[model samples]
Target chain A: MEVLDNKITKFREGLAKTNLSFREESLKYAEDTLTELDFPTTRVERWKYTRVAKIANTQFSSRKDVVKQLNLPIQDAYTVVLVNGYFDKELSSKNLPEGVEISATSQSANNLLGKVATIKNEVFTALNTLYATDGVSLRIKAKTIVDKPIQLVHVITGENTIATVRNVLVSERFSEAEVVQVFLSENANASFTNNVSEIIVEEGAKLVLDKLQNESESNFHYSNECVQQASNSNFKINTITLNGGLVRNDLTIDVDGENCETHLNGAYILKGKQHVDNHTVVNHLKPNCHSNEMYKGVMDDQSTGVFNGRILVSKDSQKIEAYQSNGNVLLSDSASINSKPELEIYADNVKCSHGSTTGQLDDEAIYYLRTRGISEKSAKALMVTAFISDVTKRMDNDKVVEYVHNQLHDRFGWDF
Target chain B: MIKITNLHASINGKEILKGLDLEVKAGEVHAIMGPNGAGKSTLASILAGREDYEVTEGSVDFDGVDLLALNTEDRAREGLFLAFQYPVEIPGVSNVNFLRTALNEIREYRGQEQIPAKDFLAMVKEKSKLVELDAGLASRAVNEGFSGGEKKRNEIFQMAMLEPKLAILDETDSGLDIDALRIVSNGVNALKSDNNATIVITHYQRLLDYIVPDFVHVLHDGKIVKTGPKELALELEEKGYDWLK
Candidate 1:
């Protein structure tokens, strides 16, 4: 067999020891789906700007090492720690709220673990489903408000290792909570991470999910998140991609009920031949729903960035309000960005608008600053900061805002 | 405090300032009056070391240094300030923060101590009051959402903070009402000192009523054809530039 097929055969042989009935069923479905789909290339419409040939040709194997002790994210809430995509129970928080449930993948008794994200057409997600051995299954019961933020920290520490994690989160009726998922690595290693998250927000529930991806620059990271919202429920996802070699995020949220709100905001900064892509889909399937998405990027020194926002308002979805915008700045002559904001509306009574803008710093504005005695360097930094201010203001958490702001400042050498 | 001789400049091969000569000493305010397209603002831009204009032939001396060779920020550091005809609106950058940064840049060039936060705040309060700028506007972004009159006042407010040796007000009185013009001119009169100079570029003599100029030069066809005292402004304001043409 070819190496690609051999990797699949090796993956199936490893998954032969699955014990859970639902997971075992999902593994079979994943195996069948993977056979039908291949890793996406640039020819595909949805991934026309991203190239994934290296990821497909690389020799990847599931690798793990028991980390006796590790430092978790500094947070005041329940912490779920994962090393090499396996849940480290000894390192996670033991004490929990009365209605909030957390468990390991092998011992999970939750029925909603693999029930949310059922889209099998995505190859990466199917690969994640077939190879993910352990992850977190969490749910908040009705009317339970978790004051502290539940943080899931994923650490990668190996070379040529492939780690896949599957996270399932279901917030019941009227429940409100905040969750922060972080990806971090200590060294520059050639690794691959395929993470899939399935989230469900039932009637009147509100959930705030934030993702911070700061992996090694030599690694490839891909995440596919699918969320479903019911009537009067709200879901918001804030993603900040700080540093990565080849990163692609595909987040889709289905607004399936009336009077629902969905928001997706992301910001990225890349330099030195780095590549980042952000693709978001906000689907309004019912009447009286609203969706908003904004993504901004700043690339320099031959780096590349792509932002594709697709807002789909179904035929039966009346009185829908949707807005999407993407703005990018290319600081170097060789740096480039491709931004496309697409809106597909079938509803007659919908108000939808989409726009995108890509350009360099305003020369007139730069000259204005220079006449004020500010150096050209400081002036450029200030203008770039101003360019991303609107997107940064969308972040709700102060700590996360400060963290992202400091990262951008430190990365762009705008610390002054 | 500044001298220019036989200054010739152009934009895209179209000459704007042709053989323009001017001289200003300490404690003097000179108003260069002209009609539209007479290159009045072009002269101001060139003096502040704007790059858009190609100085095919000319020279500018600021206090004794070759001002034509300095960069924009370097000219600003050496005490040349140009209040733009259309002040650029920069959102997300606070007015006070920009002023403080500009002040520190000038200070750093002079090898002076950076101002403390407490002193900076005090200076903001006092200088903004001098220009009659609202306390709220001082904390907001630089000229973002500001009215026409407020933007002109902000230009003067920056002038008050920086205390430039040669301040060129490009059309500072264009969009202001009579009352705004009076208040803005009052601020200019208050800042006038023996060691510093001001160049007021205007189209009307109404502003000359408040901040009286020592010399009034008429720039026609890229050259100053007439130079006189303050009364010359009234003559042109009544008869218009057609008489000179």
Candidate 2:
């Protein structure tokens, strides 16, 4: 208790230095949550396989001077920039889709906004809400579909700096949209980043959210994503974490209605001393819903990867079908992977299965390729590409899949 | 132009080929028939430079070069091709891409420029027709999900593309139906020329009818137990290996 109070006091002191709005209320919320709730530790069920508290105890401060170094090529998509957890309108674009509404509001605005108010209980969420100068609230009107993807870029630039950002997405009935959140850090020094995003898919709606985390090797990243799907709605989340120091992502999907489909897919390629952890939970609250989760990791050098997936089928969720699979490949002997896939079903009529496997490159495949005149290195690269091709094929967008393939080839120093 | 003298090979510390001797000049077709566990595959593997089979005491000369010393891919670049009894399936690697890479690599190894895409596609179309393979199968992943007969036919297609100096078909007749067998044999026979040779290893004498060999050798217990003309195959078929035993 004393340690928690001291950490909160230190956090409050750090926030006081940042000249951002809602300083007082954010500090109060952080203090209250810190004192009331226990910080997620290694002992926590969901966090058992990951050690996040060790990163939180490092006494990171908000990066006040780090916002100037980011220089990204201007893209055609509607671009929004969040620097060190604070929205920067000067660096962002105002172009948005038709029938889409975006505004900054307080917690007591309405029921729609009230759903985001629960973020106060999470320390990082509370910190983002408290220190956030402006939060992006996106609401799509009924039956409206956005053709362009919304690009959210989060840039971290300073050393020993901590930043938190929040995003709230609400899709109206029969609407469709896609949101792409890209996290990048320009500097190679030590830094900390915490991000929270909430997505609500209404009845008969479809939402696709893609996350690209390409932070520096000296940064610690933690992200929490929560999605709620309504009747006959479809929600898909694709996360690509390419590089980071210590990264942990938490994804929770709640199927609140029947005939809904939820897909959670991710691919991570890590090297050096990087550590990446992905934890996902799918709760089937209604019957006749389908959920699928597939996550793949490719680790080299002394890097470490972790994957933990859980599927929960409630008693009334009969005839539900859920599948989860986690596959990893260790490119070097020094690399390590820890994967755990679990299922808990209270209904006997439901079909739920989960599996995980970790292996090195197939030797027979390598030999077979080499026998056909391909060099050992090229053969290994081909096998690695083949191993990850399934995940890339799942991306319905050709350009995105091509971009991912190029990124993977660049990492492996191969020209595909 | 291949020679193996006193070749002794082993896999996992178990000797499979014991002091085997064989020689084949250009423009010659040699058939090696044997019973099960007769080390015929071992001899072919050793000749193709499969690293899993160690040449404990042997010497293999291919086109006057040290065949045993070359790496698998280098040997492949040197015009040594092995048509595996069980072809490997490589998913996501299109057959066209795979064959193109192999051909270009071999060409580069021989100090030649890459084949132009137009020329290469023309070659693929021509060779694919020779093997009676569908154009769709030629673009899919390398041998992935291909039927047994299709795999064999694809092997011959690759052989035709590579134009190896010495083609070693290891039990290419197995798992292939009569029509596929005829197509594969026809493809192989079409590829034969005066400047290259072939080593056909089989357990049955039926395939020999389609691909008639100039020299037929019966391999038993890792050694050539008998040598005769193409009529030897018919005789062996009429009188099973029990007569030799």
Residue B93, model 2: Cα distance from true site in angstroms: 3.7
Q: Distance (Å) between predicted and true CA of A126, model 1?
A: 0.4
Q: TM-score for the first chain of model 1?
A: 0.93
Off by over 4 Å in 1: A1-25, A65-77, A89-91, B239-245
In candidate 2, the residue pairs with backbone N, CA or C atoms under 3 Å apart (3 or more residues apart, or in different chains) clash, namely: none
Interface RMSD of each: 1.1, 1.4
Docking class of 1: medium
lDDT of 1 by residue, A132-198 (tens): 7677788999999998888888877778677788888889999999988888875538788888888
* TM-score per model over all chains: 0.92, 0.90
- The DockQ-based CAPRI class assigned to model 2 is medium
lDDT score, candidate 1, position A179: 89
